[model samples]
Target: MKKYLDIISDLGEGFGSYSIADDSSLLALVSSANIACGFHAGDPRTMASAVEKSIENNVGVGAHPGFPDLVGFGRRAMDLSSWEVTTDILYQIGALHAFVKAYGGELQHVTPHGKLGNFSVVDQRYAKAIAEGIAMFDPSLIVVTMPGELAEAAKKKGLRVAYTIFADRTYNDDGTLVARSNPHAVIRDPDTVVERVIRMVNEGKVTSITGKEIEVNGHSLLLHGDTPGSLQLAKQIKNALMSAEIEIRRLGDWIN
Candidate 1:
């Protein structure tokens, strides 16, 4: 049997007059796009453009909600109540969904961005709030999650869950991503990234920062658009996966 996977990239991350990644090129390479809402790194114009392009490319559309930390790029931690988290997520998802609807495409999934995503991994309150917000919006939307509280919360809320692994980020022994504060948290080499992704998909495991091999449920592979050399890396990874005989499909199409 052939192994199947989904390739996704964080996109629509440009603010007014400043763009982050080559979304067009990346869109051609990825099967799914986690578009940024206005809160973190996008505005109405960019969001609209992203939706249009995603429709053109037949890529799955997803909302990437995050903390209202533009200066910090949603990487810095913020103090927010559970209600605030839920409402903010709902608002972002609604904003992105409107564009998706306009473009004749349905919103596919919800993947929390930056620090909010990191927080939800261990903090049940944050995870539950995220799950509740997503469930309230549309219980049918798939929630892309790591091995963490968010996965459990999504399950409890009767939402579909798709497990994901980061292609450019390192993991901990417990299966959580290594914090960005750590210098070695990100894997920069394209070859290394490709090797790890192949292993994760084929063997269902990842080697942690501490040299511990940990199990991973690899449904989707996340490639950060903002990473340096990401376009080249995405191409390499895609070609490598194809060469390895793995089928790449959009999560919304096949993930149950």
Candidate 2:
């Protein structure tokens, strides 16, 4: 545990450039940043600014691609063909990579956001499509995915996989996240979030909403920057992990 913790911050719609939470404190606490790529939120300017800030803070930058549903904020599921999903991913990654290159930085990873990520996990064909898209873009780029299903698919496709877990979210008995629509899904309490993360890192387990302890292989921990009290929770999570002898680092440093 002391050598393998990567803290990530999700920069979504509610916490874009126009929001109060998009600032240095959040950037400082996180080692990897998932920046929205215009589908769910963020424009060209916001993406460029976020990329610049991430580089300035020496944090790893990744593209946060989502469904093309601005009205739904990419949270609502949509029926998309595998090819369509693959093309969407390529467009989003290309958009962010251009900004990163302009700033003399590299796009380190790709994390599908919202409904796309949820659907990809349960649908192996969708997962493979996403993996192929990432592999096509650059074989060296890592794919940050939900720890179990999508990560396995990406690995099978020979893409470097970053198995990600969420610090501010609840898990199901099978290690999938409790649906966001559920009342217990989002862990709003900072102390609880810290404790859950520590247990996941040290014991390789997460207590699900049903009180079942499920095994989890978390290569990285995600903190949703748009969630209420997210920055405070991130600080507490990092401190607790460090106290427990877990060393937090960027995902790029761990990927082969």
Candidate 3:
């Protein structure tokens, strides 16, 4: 049987006079968007604009909070206490929530960004902090995370969770993503990504870089907006899923 999946992408990842990929094109393809919350790559204006665009496109709005690393684009790890991580995530969610409310759209989810995201997956303390932070904001909101400490923390904190797997990134045998330092971390070929995503959803598994078959839960599939030709790749993946008769919708709409 064909598997249903939710499509999500990053948005609002540009500062003044600097833009990344065309977010408008991606908005047309994804059902949910994880908008950057100014710490990583977005500014206030950019966050507001992304929220507005998401509202116009009828896409689910989510907070994409990361480390306070503008220089490293939040991909570099930082030395932060669990309380600090929780507060940082809370602040970003509040910032994005204002935009979401002003645009007459409810915030649907929270997804940690970059290094913060990867860390939350491994460190139970950080994961619990993130989940606690989201619970403080809105317990009804969903947390998009991989199957690990973050997911466990979210569930234990009485927050909703939707398991997320990457469509264009390779996983490790331990179910973590391959280190970005490796040259082959991201799978850029559009056709290959589409096929891999199909397998993940339909077969409930993905092949790790070490040739291990690792099972994956697929409440949502993520595609990085900053990737080359990401817009076309997202479109093709959505089309491919549709052709396979997989129901692609927003996490908020389907998680229940």
Q: For model 1, which pairs clash?
A: none
CA error at residue 106 for candidate 1, angstroms: 0.5
Reference-based TM-score of each model: 0.98, 0.95, 0.97
User: Total clashes, candidate 2?
Assistant: 0
- What's the lDDT for candidate 3? 0.91
Q: Order the numbered candidates by TM-score, best leading.
A: 1, 3, 2
Better of 1 and 3 by lDDT: 1
Residue 3's lDDT within candidate 1 is 83
Could you tell me the TM-score of candidate 3? 0.97
Task: Assess the local accuracy of residue 90 in candidate 2 as a C-alpha lDDT between 0 and 100.
Answer: 93
User: Considering only N, C-alpha and C atoms within 3 Å, which residue pairs clash in candidate 2?
Assistant: none
- lDDT of each model, Cα atoms only? 0.93, 0.83, 0.91
Writing each residue's lDDT as its tens digit, candidate 2 over 9-83 gives 876344343653555788889899898899988888788888999999999999999999988888998888989
C-alpha lDDT of candidate 1 relative to the true structure:
0.93
Candidate 1, residues 1-256: lDDT per residue as tens digits? 9788999999999998899999999999999999999998999999999999998999999999999999999999998999999999999999999999998999999999999998988899999999999999999999997878999999999999998888989998888888888999999988889999999999998899999998988799999878788889999999999999999999988987
Judging by TM-score against the true structure, name the best candidate: 1
